[model samples]
Target chain A: MRLYLAYFKIKFLNEIQYKVAALAGIATQFAWGFMYIMLFTTFINNSDTNAISSSQIVTYIWLQQAFYMLFAFWSVDKDIFDSISSGNLAYELTKPVNLYDIWFIKTLALKVGKTVLRALPIFLICMLPFLGEFTMTAPVSIMAAVWFVITMFFSTILILSYIMIIYILTITAISPLGVKITFSLMGDFFSGGLIPIPLMPDIVQTILKYTPFYYIQNIPYNIYNGYISGNLEIIKIVGIQVFWIVILIALGKLLMKNSMKKVVIQGG
Target chain B: MIELKNITKTYRVRKRSAGMKNAFKTFFKKDYEVIKALDDISFEINEGEMVGYIGPNGAGKSTTIKIMAGILTPDSGQANISGLIPWKQRTKYVKDIGVVFGNRSGLWWDVPVDDSFELLKNIYKIPDDVYKQQKTKLVKLLDIGEIIKIPTRQLSLGQRMRCEIASAFLHKPKIVFLDEPTIGLDAVSKIAVREFIKKINKEDKTTIILTTHDTQDIEALTNRIILIGKGKILLDGKLSDLKKKFSKKYLTVEFNGDIDQLCDGLIFIEKYKGRIIIELNENILTLAKAIAFLTSKIEILDLEVDNTSVDDIVVKLYQEYGI
Candidate 1:
């Protein structure tokens, strides 16, 4: 655990060095937030189907933008991927640490560090009164806020385990491009990054619920906005999150073990 | 202690021909060619022995090092290092070993060298006092006290390399594998590295296995040489023995009179206005006999005798092995 913390600390410090990139990312996330809210406002206004309120949708979009770094599947650290492709992973293997845990913590640190840089400002701006009806609201209650925090933590780990599978696949893959693109696109669309689960077709939502993807951003953001309420419902949602986390982690570790067996470092 | 027997590794490299057509074809139907990287390689090294593992390109030198370091699993082999199989007991085995790949960095690039060392301390679970003492000793020995405080990216290659060696030693590993440690280093840096390696090997009794193309590194640091070529161990013996076996005496004579003829044992290499160079087959004629014969033929003013160089001996060995 201490070894992984050390790896995380170094990667966090390394990530926070890119101040200019962080600034650019913050700006891009805000632009994307406004664009998504504006596009969805028309649907909410015209549609009779009130799956979720307009205010909840506004909060959802804002939360998505604020924690974009944490939930986005495509935002993998390029350096880590390059290390695998370039055979610099050989250096990593020489260390007396589990390779999977090192990469997992490093990537977790990267996402958390990046989220720290961009989330606060987006939160403050989205909550401002100037945004009027589009402004992000606070949690429904203190209990809901607690559940949000708990579920978000589990959700992040669940998504990370899914991403770890992608990383393990990259070890045996001849090219990381196809694997990265295919997985990220599928992950992003299914995990409610492209469109919120409530707005999607019922059949799509039902199918997503069976997989781990539905529990990712869909559960936590909804709980925070009061879309998912009551102690019993929250407990059930959190239970499902924990279940998926265990399953995804087990699947990732199994894939990682198999891939590591045949892993060939590319260069001398 | 370390031992390897019949270690074999084969790589299936994707084969492709030139032109866009072949590239397209390979994308649809890939062809792989199996290369026998390590062919029945076997060797043993006792503690505190500095052995040089040398080979030409694609001769499986790095593969052997990786296997020993626990980063690679050979197809068929038995490697026992300190009563543990490297690949089977990876984490435990790696704790007792350190490896440095010259072309790639093991340090965190954006952080100070000291930070990387601290991370390593945690990774290896070294006690605070031991960590501090080791860090101080390594920083002093590598002369990177100031450099370690700066980010690794800002340091020069030589300075970074020194830090690299230090990072690898922070845990005081029992065995160190250095693959081309002095590569691209200037003379002074090379000597500093060589001296540091020698100092560590002597002081810690750490077994060092170095693979380098630079013969000077092997000559300066290690006495035992294990030469591998074409996936096979071509030579393994003391450096002095290989030197004596391949050594030839070259006699350069400065004379006033021109030599009309030469004996069977003396083969003329070059003829200048006042100097003549001849190679003496030591088996056939001794150096004293060559001088006697040369003096009798021409009035020798000055004569110099030189033996074959290490570089020539390596080239000769490579040629002999047909690698």
Candidate 2:
């Protein structure tokens, strides 16, 4: 546990060293948020359905943008690929810790640290006078806030499991770049980062609800918006998230175990 | 103690021709060739012994080191170190071993060396007191106190290599595998690294296996050497014995009078002014007999006898083995 924490600390410090990249990311996410809010507001104005209000879409866009570092499918852990190609993986393998757990902690630290660094700035930017309407509202109730936190926690684990699958695929597949780009694009389009799931067509929403990508961003945003208010409904949502987390974790572990047996450190 | 029996490792490397057509064809259906990186190689090293592992390019030196360090699993073999099989008990066995690859940087490039050390301290689970003691000792021994606070990317190759070696010893590992430790180092830096390695081996009783292309490093560091070629152990013995086996003695004499012809066993190499150089085979011609014959033939003004250097002997060995 201590060793894992040490990895986390090192990775956190490493990520924060690129302050320019963090600032630039905040700027880009704010621009995207503004465009999204305009598009969603125009769409809401033409619709009569009350399934999701214009204000709710605005808040969802704002929240997703503020937490883009967490929601996006960026390569949160480039070190894994770097180590493999640079032949440092051999040295890392000899360390007295599980390779999977160490990388997991590092990736977690990278996401959490970068998210913390950018989320507040983006949120503050969204709260400015011109963009005040896009600012996220506080949780409707304490119970909603509690469920929001729980869902966000599970969302983190689910995303980690997803990333683990990519890491393993990099070892087994001939080229993981195509796979990574495809997954990233799919994750954004289907995970409610581009458009809120509730506003999508019923068929699309239904299909997404059954996929793990929906839980990554959509569920947490909905819980924060108080869309899932009843105790039974909240429990059901949390249970689904947990189920996906377990399944993804199990698949990730099995893939990692099989792929590691054929690991070839590319260069000396 | 370390023991290896019939350790073998093979790599499957993709093959393709140069033309675009061939490249396109390979893209669809690749060809693979099997490369035997290690083939039935076996050796033993007792505790507190330092051995030099020398070979030319692609001679399985790094492969052997990786297998012994628990980073690689052999295709078939038994490798037991400190009563634990390296590949079988990887995590536990690696606790007592350290590995240094010259072409790789084990330290984080963006952080201070001290931060990397602290991280390793936790990774190895060293006691706080022990960690401090070992850190101080290694830092002082390597004379890297001033540079430890600087980021690794800011240091020169020599400074970074020093930190690398020091970091590997921070946990007080019982065994260390140094693959090309002095590679690309200046003469002074090389001497400093060699001295540090010797100091640790003598003071801490740490066993070391060093692989290098530089024969000077072998001469300055280890008494025993294992030479490998074509994924097999071609020679393993004391360094002195290898030199004795391949070295030829040479006698150079300056005399007032010398004949144009030489004896049957003596081959004249050069004659300049009044000096004559002759190659002598110890097996065919005794040193005493050669000296007597030369002295009887001419009035000797000056004489010198010399044996081949370790470097020459190694080159000869490599050629004889056709590696």
Candidate 3:
């Protein structure tokens, strides 16, 4: 755990060296956050369906956009996979440590830095305009925000396991682009990044329920928007994430062992 | 300790004719061919033996090293290194071996060599005292004290290869695998690397398995040679044995007094006004008889016999095997 924290610190420092890029990320996050807020407001203004009430819709959209990186699993998880597949994995392997823990720490650090530099600032920027229409007195709502962050962290690991499976074979076939493309479209819609699941028709929801994407985004959206208000639902979501974390970590370890069996790096 | 039995490895690669149509055709139904990289290879090295693994290009030298290093599992064979099966107990097995691949770096590109070494130390959890003592020794021996602090990107190829060898030895593993330790090095750098490797192997008894195209590397460092050709162990013997078999013969002669007539089989190869030298095939005429025949006819010059060098032996081996 201490090593992981140190690795996180090192990764953050390395990332901060590119100050302009970091600032640009924060700026981009804010622009996209504000755009989503405006789009949700227009949807409520122009439609009678009232699929989502204006204030609730705006709040959920802000949080969703703020935490876009947390929803990133399939597309973002390949960073580690790519490193491991290219004989570059030796750099990590020669270390007298576990591959999972080291990568796990660095990955969380990247996402956390993104969350801090981009998401936190974007949330702050909306405060000036959102203060007038929203109620800030709900401290229980703050608990939901905390749970959503935890969900995103665990969700990232679950998604990484799937990506690692593709990477293991990437070492064999000599490419990961195909697997990356597979994750992009299906992962985006399934994870509720394209559209909120409950807003989807009944049949789509039934189909998506079987996929892990719902746990990544839709459930978090429910918590953020008061659709899931009870403490019990928060516990269930956290429990699901913990469950996946255990299973996925184990699966990743197994694949790592099997993958090493075939990686011939001597002359290559 | 390392042992390999009947190891075979094949790689399936996609192949296609050059054209957009072929590319499109490959996408739908790829033409794949299995290349037999290693075919029924076997060998064994006792502990503390610094053996050189040599072969012509694409003779499966790297494949053998990779399998022994636990990077690949053979298609059909049993391999045991230090009483551990490599592919099965990978994590534990790898902890005891240090590997350096020439032409590729294991160091982080943007970081200083020390930073990379520090990370490796932490990763291996080496005792600070042990790490410090060994590092100091290697630094002094390789004369890389000033180089280690520089970023890897800034170091020259020779400087970096020294650091690379040191990095691999930090853990003081039972065996060190060097794919091509002296590749692309200047003559001085080559000698320094060879001396450093020789000192370590002599002092610490560190078993080393090295593969290199540099014959001088084999000559200067290791005496035992395992020659592989066409994916099989063709020759396994000492440097002297190999020399006696295929090495060239050289005999130098200096005139005791001025001479004119040269005997047959002894061609006048070099002449420096009043000094005479001759070249002859040792197989066709023995040196003593040639000298005796010359001395009987005329006053003879000083003469010395020298066996062919390992470099010439390697060239002849390559030609004879036709690899």
Candidate 4:
């Protein structure tokens, strides 16, 4: 556990060095947020009656933009891929720590660090006096706020587990780019990043509810908007999130163990 | 404390020819060639022995090192290091060993060297007192006190290599495997690294297994040399013994007058106006007999006898094995 914390600290410090990249990411996400708001507003205006109000939809889009880094599946970590390709894997494998946990902690630190760096600035910019109207509303109740945090915690675990599977694939000599693109597109499409789950057709929403992607961003977003109310519903949603986290983690561990058996550290 | 018996490792490398057509064909149907990386290699090193593992390119030097370091498992072999199988007891076995690859940077590129050391301290679970004591000793020995505060990327190759060696020692591992540690280092840096390696081997009684192409490193550091070629252990014995076995005696004499004549065992290598160089084979003729024969033929003014160096003996071994 202490070793993992060391990995976290080093990776967090490493990610903080890329402040310029984080600033650029915030600008790009803000632009996308505006585009999403306009699209959502037009959809709500054309519909005779909507499940979610226009103000709530606008706030959802803003929140999605702020949490983009946390929910999104980025590329396979190039540092790890390069380490394997450049033969640094030899040194990495010889460490006393478990290889899976080493990468898991590093990946978690990178994601959380970048999210904090970019999301805080985006959140502040949205909360400015002039932009207050576009900002998300506070959670409907204290329960909603508490469930939001709980669901987001589980959501992060699910996403990290998903990324770990891709990393394991990379070590097994399969290119992660193809899997990354497919998974990213599917995750964005179903996780309410491109379109909110409530606005989607009922059939599509039903299908997404069965997929783990729905629990990642959509659940947290819905909780923040007070769409998922009552203690019973929040507990059920948190239960499903925990289930997916465990399943994904088990799959990652199995793949890692099998792949490492035939591990080949190429080059000198 | 380390033993390997009949270790063998084979790598299946994909074979592809150049040209777009061949590339496309290989994408569909690939051909693989099995390369014997380590072929029945066996050796034993007692604790605190500094053994130089030397070989030519593709001679399985890195493969053997990897197997010993627990980075790769041999296909068929029994390897026991510190009474634990490296690959089977990887987590526990690795804690007692440190490895340094010359071409790779084990330290974090963007952080200060000391930060990486701290991380390693945590990774190895070293107590604060032990960590500080080891770090201080390594810093002074490697002369890297100032550079430890700088990021690894900003340091020169020599400085980085020094820091890398120091990082490997921070955990105070019982066994250290160095693969080409002095590669690409300047003469001074090379000597410094050699001296430091000697110091640790002497002071800590740490077993050091070094693989290098530089014969000077072998000459300066290790008394025993294990030469591998073509995935097989070609030679393993005292460095002095190997040198003496392959060493040829060279006799250079400045003669006042010389007659054009040659002996059965002596091969005339070069001849000038008054100077002549001849190689003596000890099996055919003794040095005393050669001198008697040579003096009778010509009036010798000055004579010098020299034996082959370790470098020459290694080159001769490589050529003889056709590796």
lDDT tens string, model 4, B90-199? 99999999999988999998999999999999999999999999999999999999999999999999999999999999999999999999999999999999999999
Better of 2 and 3 by TM-score: 2
Q: What residue pairs clash in candidate 2, if any at all?
A: none
Candidate 3: C-alpha lDDT: 0.73
Measured by TM-score, the strongest candidate is 1
Per-residue lDDT over A93-174 for candidate 1, one digit per residue giving the tens place of the 0 to 100 score: 8888888888889889999999999999999988899989889999989998998999999999988988888898888887
lDDT of each residue in A1-268, candidate 2, tens digit only: 8898899999899888888888998888888888998898888888788888777777788888878888788746777777765668887887888887887898899898888888998777666667567766777788888888888899988888888777777776665677678777887788877778888899998888889987888887887786657889878878988999899888988987776677766444
Error of 1 at B188 (Å): 1.2
Q: What are the per-residue Cα lDDT tens digits for candidate 2 across B1-323? A: 89999999999999988898998997679899999999999999999999999888999999999889887778999988999998878889999988899889999889999999999999999999999999999988889999999999999999999999998898999999999999899999899999999999999999999999889999999999999999999999999888778878899998897578777679988888798899998888899999898888889988999989878978998998999
Give per-residue CA lDDT, model 4, range A1-268, as digits (tens). Answer: 7888989999899888998998898999999988888888887889876688877786678778887877777633568877765778888887898988898898888888888888887777776767655676777788888888888889888888888887787776646567667777877777777788888988988998888888888887788787767889889888998898899999999998888778887666
lDDT of 2: 0.86
Report the lDDT of model 3 for residue A127.
56
Off by over 4 Å in 3: A1-12, A49-51, A74-86, A90-103, A129-142, A225-227, A250-259, A262-267, B20-31, B251-307
Error of 3 at B186 (Å): 2.7
TM-scores of chain B alone in all candidate structures, in the order given: 0.95, 0.92, 0.88, 0.92
* lDDT for residue A57 in candidate 3, whole number 0-100: 61
The lowest-lDDT stretch of 10 consecutive residues in candidate 1 chain B is: B257-266
DockQ of each: 0.76, 0.68, 0.39, 0.77
Give the lowest summed-lDDT range of ten residues in model 2 chain B: B257-266
**Candidate 4 colliding pairs:** none
User: What are the runs in model 2 whose C-alpha is more than 4 Å off?
Assistant: A128-132, B251-266, B273-276, B282-306
- Superposing all C-alpha atoms, what RMSD in Å does each candidate have to the true structure? 1.6, 2.3, 3.9, 2.3
Candidates' C-alpha lDDT: 0.90, 0.86, 0.73, 0.88
